[model samples]
Target: NFILFKTISSCLFFFFFFRSYGGKILVFPFDGSHWVNMEVLLQALHSRGHNITVVRNSKSWYIKENSTYYNIITVPVERGIDQEFITNTTSGIMEFERGALPLTSFLHLTVTIFHIMIEVHKIFIDFVLAMLNDPDFLKMLKYSNFDLVLTDPSWGGGAIFAKYLNLPLVYNVRWILAKEAHFSLAPSPVSHIPITGTGYTDKMTFLQRVKNMMFYLLAQIHYYLMITQTYQQLCEKTLGPNIDFNELSLSADLWLMRVDFVFEYPRPTMPNFVYMGGFQCTPAKPLPQHLEDFVQSSGEHGVILMSMGTFVSALPADMTNEIAAAFAKLPQKVIWRHKGDRPANLGNNTLLVDWMPQNDLLGHPKMKLFVAHGGTNGLQEALYHGIPVVGIPLFFDQYDNLMRLKERGGAQILTLSTVDKENNFLKAVEEVLNEPSYRMNMQRLSRLHRDQPMKPLDNALFWMEFVMRHKGAAHLRTESYRMPWYSYYSVDVGLFLFGVFLLVVTTVFILMRCLYRTVCKPKVKQE
Candidate 1:
């Protein structure tokens, strides 16, 4: 009886302690697949008794109007990066990848993607303006007394909003504006650190290094012309003339990076950047009875899982038939998440579902291989579960993500242009299955990923709460972002030193000439 009473008392004490200390966090999230991971962080924070208020748009693609974990504040907008936009953009990219020459394809693809991104940013800027210009919205936000703003820096409005509210800012980030988050927050040397979309690794040949620099410069130009100039105008008009958008974008109190060294190549990172790769991953829960029964029925042959992430629901009909034919040849039972018309060549061995429990399936004991489009979240999950991958890179950073795994020897890459030609898909799948090294290397990565001292999600939560406790994590942030480009790189200091050395040399030369004249004049007069 006494022990029972003690247990009850402890439970009550913790319950009250958590209730009293819970923070009020305001979330401004990016929609689509980015929301998928951001929602994971929100759920964790909600479990810890935090009060989460999510600011979403009326045209939001993935963020629902209602959720169990967070309250929604919907901002009405006419148009956004909705389903139609994504589908059309993806279709155009596919057309380019499948037909154009390599150089023409790259140039066209870059311009198209840049144009789409600019449109998205312009919409977000208008969204921010709508929120700021409304008096009632401003009053409500100010009265809420939020502790910090948690946001994804893929869009700039969140940072701008946080600055306007005078609240601390934290980012659930992998990309910031037009490039990888590290490029904004860390010292990125172009010689080693490969730019996104380049499909080059850290160890680059001289020609590759030159291409890497060109890519980096292109990204910088895109950011400056498309993002910085536009956002800077908005910042000045809304916040104050003194506000610099680039600095505001980098001035977050903490950065919860969505990658770790297990997946990412070695590079310099900032103190405020905390890697929480695979934070969304957990031990697989029990499968539904029907799903379990289907798995057990596979007998000696294990199951293969395939998904193309949130977007790209289905491929072109011919491409679909090609993939279906390859799966028909595989001995392993396959579960593929697909939409659109059923493939003509789909075998009885393959099951096509509109959706599947991807993580749970990946974690299953009988799971053998993952056929994926190489999204970051899916790749991290594959690493966590030790599943070898056959990556069919479609667009965006998909090729680069798969390249990282291929470099580590755990995955194979089949480009969209070649996925349907010459029996490539079937041969690649067979190669991974027949080879022992693929599974061995992947399992090795899984062990290393799981060997962290603290769970990635818990680490993320602690830092978030740490920011709340401390009001902000300014000490962890570097003031280098506030410096001018020349000042940050010490170009000005180098030039100053160079000028001083030249002055000393000039003065010494003048003095030597005078001394020579004095001595020689006396000698000449005497002669």
Candidate 2:
């Protein structure tokens, strides 16, 4: 009886201990694909008894008005990045990729992308104004007394809101305001660290490095013109003229980066930047009955899974026909997530579903290869499942994500322009499937990724709780962002030392010349 009483007491103690540590978190999330990952984090937090309130636009693409895990504070807006905008932008990029003139296509793509970015940021700014201008909403937020603001830093509204609330800020981050989070928070040397969209790796030739530097410069220009100036105006109008949006972006107490070295190339990172790559990945659950039957039917030949992620619902008709025709040539059964008109060339071995269980399908024993658009979440899931990939990157960071895996010998990349021509899709798929090295290398990566001391999700949770408990992690944050460019690089000190060296050399030379004239002139006169 005494022993039973002790066990009960211990159980109660632990239960209360966890219950007391539950925090109130205010989440500002980016919609679309980013929300998919953020929702994973939110669910975990919800299971841990944390109170999560998500701030979303009324017309958000993926985020709904209702959720079991979190409360929603929807900001009504006339404009938001909806499906139509994404579809149009993606279609334009596709057209540009297929254009005959390379230089002209490149220029058009750049201009179109920049214009889209400007429009998106303008919408984000409008959302921020709507929120700030609402007195009742502001009062409700202020009184909530949240422990920390957890946000994806892709958009600046969250960071701005956190500052306005005077709450501790934490980031569930991969991308920041205008670039990758690492470039904003770490020492990103262009010589080795390739900028996004460059299609180069850490090991670069001289010309590649030159191109990398140029891209880095272009990113900086984009940040200054599109992000800094635009957001700075909002900051001044809302918070104060003294507030710096760039510095605010870097001021997160903890950065839960969505990548680890197993997937990302080795590079310098900040103390507060914690990598939790593949945190959203979990062991596969049993597939749906029909899906299970389909997998079982594949027999010894195995299966290939294809998804273009959340953004690209379907490809152009001709391209889809090319892909479908190529799939017809393969022995393996194909399960494709396609949301468009049925392709006439689609084979008997292929099944078209509006959606498939991507992670579960990847983890299945019959799964042989993945045909993906190279989204980070999808690639990470593939890595977790030890599956080789044939990457057909469409836009944004997709190509870069694939390039990382290709560099590691676990994946093959095919450009959109080349994928439809000369049986490239079939060739690339066949190469990955037949190549022993592709699967072996990917399995090796899987081992390395799984060999972590702690699971990525647990690590992320611990740091988040650490921030909540401590109020903030200011000590781990660097003041380098506050430094002027000359001071940060020590250029001023180098110039000062150079000037001192010149002065000393000139003084010594002058003394030696005088000594020679004074001593030698008298001797010559005596002679």
Candidate 3:
């Protein structure tokens, strides 16, 4: 067994080795969640001799500025308005006065989509035009012919660049492709596949399925009716109208979606849609001395690590105080990532820091529970470490994410709005900490996640390099992308079947009437 294992490992290594002959790869990562995962993959590819150049707007803050293997080119665009609006809205989810929109409301969802599309379209068009307007930058890109263009599908600029430069384009998604991307590339029937922001699962009730279908149709109809023409015009103005940005995007050579069966529900995905959900996660390193000592000193009671991710670092004062008070009563020590002053009445057992190494803390054996805002990045880390979660979901798929974890039996959720309730927060923490089943379930999942044949980084790197070597992996492109909407959904098939049924019923009714007129009328007259 040992000799056979060694032989197989050697062959796999050499396979990727020969395929590792590098190429110049261009990456366009915009969103924060995307940046975290894409950076890891980019670094891995860089180590494999690939030259990476990242093109991004000023709104992004997480891009590594000083890197030996990769280069960064910042595109100048008007940032303050859209960037400020997005930041404020995202932060407002946990703030009481801001009155964040509820995820369950269709109006809220519609408005959110409309707002995002308007802002994103503006940003995309402005960035492209600004870059095109710069002679030096345009000359630089024209001279440096990149081999592959990797992009987050949220931004259409990547598709524009690939089309203009005639480069092989690959999409890297930080979230599951259940949105518009799936509509084109995969089967997203509302019967089973849950909507991205909605909290429904694959085993949805009949009415829940209907609601899911409504959300899907509304989004699709809204896109085609409101945004399509304007987006086409933007493309025509910036890049030539000759190339359809939608078509160019749908023609992507490969798609790397941030999803895995361990974290997501089992669903059918296309051949090219590779799942590398936890690619950003790595084996936790030793914590800083102070943090390590804090956890060690917690004794048998263990520790709880709380963080709300980058965008939502601070909660409202009232909620913060409530959290502080709750932690004060608990025996377990809490290490919270807080930026400003400590909450009033903070307990001796709790410690606050400007930033905590979340993954490292979660990996600690004494870590008991994760109090989080339920962002994908944080959730994946918790799952990787096999720690049960106490989720306080605020907005934007956080609720849905936590609900899924709850279904998996490893998490318990509480809405941020209820933080002020007496003992609610404390009880949630206590229940998860005291329950053995949650811990057992999480450990089982952790084993499944870790016991994969290959690490996520390797899987991502292999697929990325494979696309580069195969010149886009054109054979992997499913016919789904090219199929028309009606055809793809089998809408035509349904209509055809309905038509045949209607025709047969009508013929039978006509024959019955004819028989009545031909024989029944004569019989009645004779009688």
Q: Per-residue CA lDDT of candidate 3, range 1-527, in tens? A: 99999999999998797656778998877666567767778878887888899987766566756678789998777762243565677654345323545544446646765666666567667777788789998788888978899988776778778877888888887432224456556766679988766788889898999888887787666656444645577777767767565566778887777768888887777888787777777778999998888899999999999998766657877788989999999999999988756787999999988877787888888999999888888898899999999998776678788887899999998876576786789899889999899999998888888888888878878887788777777788876656677997799999999999999999999999998899899889999
lDDT values for all models? 0.92, 0.92, 0.78
Candidate 1, residues 1-527: lDDT per residue as tens digits?
Answer: 99999999999998898667889999999998999999999999999989999999889889989899999999888778899888888977897789888999999988988888888889888898889888999999999999999999999988988998999999999998888999987999999999999999999999999999999999989988876656998999998899889999999999999999999999999889999999999999988887888777788889999999888988988999999999998888998899879999899888888878889999999999999999999999999999999999988889999999999999999988999999999999999998999999999999999999999999999999999999999999999999999998999999999999999999999999999999899989999
Query: Mind giving the per-residue lDDT tens digits that candidate 2 earns over 309-349?
Result: 89998999999999999999988999999999999989999
Q: TM-score of each candidate?
A: 0.97, 0.96, 0.88
Question: lDDT score, residue 357, model 2?
Answer: 81
- Clash counts for the predictions, in order: 0, 0, 0
Tell me the spans in candidate 3 whose CA falls farther than 4 Å from its real position.
Answer: 1-20, 80-86, 96-106, 175-184, 493-527
lDDT of 2 at 415: 86
**Candidate 2: C-alpha lDDT:** 0.92
Cα displacement (Å) at residue 122, model 2: 0.6
What residue runs in model 2 are displaced by over 4 Å at the alpha carbon?
Answer: 1-12, 514-527
Query: Which candidate has the top score in lDDT?
Result: 1
